[model samples]
Target: MNGLNTTALVLLIIGGINWLLVGLFQFDLVAALFGGQDGIIARIIYVIVGICALYAFTFIPAVKRRHAVE
Candidate 1:
């Protein structure tokens, strides 16, 4: 579970970076690497990023419990 959480966090960071680049420069790194937005590989990347977001949503609460200071 820890490994899964780590992987999700890494992907979320990647997705965030990609979005930042898109917002700042109108560039999509994932599309560039995978052959454009319409390509299957690019779509898979988008899907994985979204799934990682969902996983993070479910994970944060437990993470806080595990790391609580009190």
Candidate 2:
């Protein structure tokens, strides 16, 4: 689970950077690296990143636990 969390975090960071680039410069690093946006590879990359983002939800610290520290 730790490994999975780390992997998901890394992918999430990459996705965050990609979104930052898109917002600031209208660039898409993944699409360029994997071909064009419609390319199968690019679509797969996007899908994986999205899934990683979803997986990242598991890493969220529980609010109750945070307040339970003694």
Best model number under TM-score:
1
> In candidate 1, residue 21 scores what lDDT?
99
lDDT by residue (1-70, candidate 1, tens digit) is 7899889989999999999999999999999999999989999989998999997889878869989965
Q: Clashes in model 1: which pairs?
A: none
Per-residue alpha-carbon lDDT of candidate 2 for residues 1-70, written as tens digits (9 for 90 to 100)? 5788778888889999999999999999998898989999999989999999887676566545767884
Q: Which candidate achieves the best lDDT against the true structure? A: 1
- CA displacement after TM-score superposition, residue 32 of candidate 2 (Å): 0.9
Which segments of model 1 are wrong by more than 4 Å?
A: 66-70
Name the lDDT value of residue 30 in candidate 2: 92
In Å, residue 23's CA in model 2 sits off its true spot by 0.3
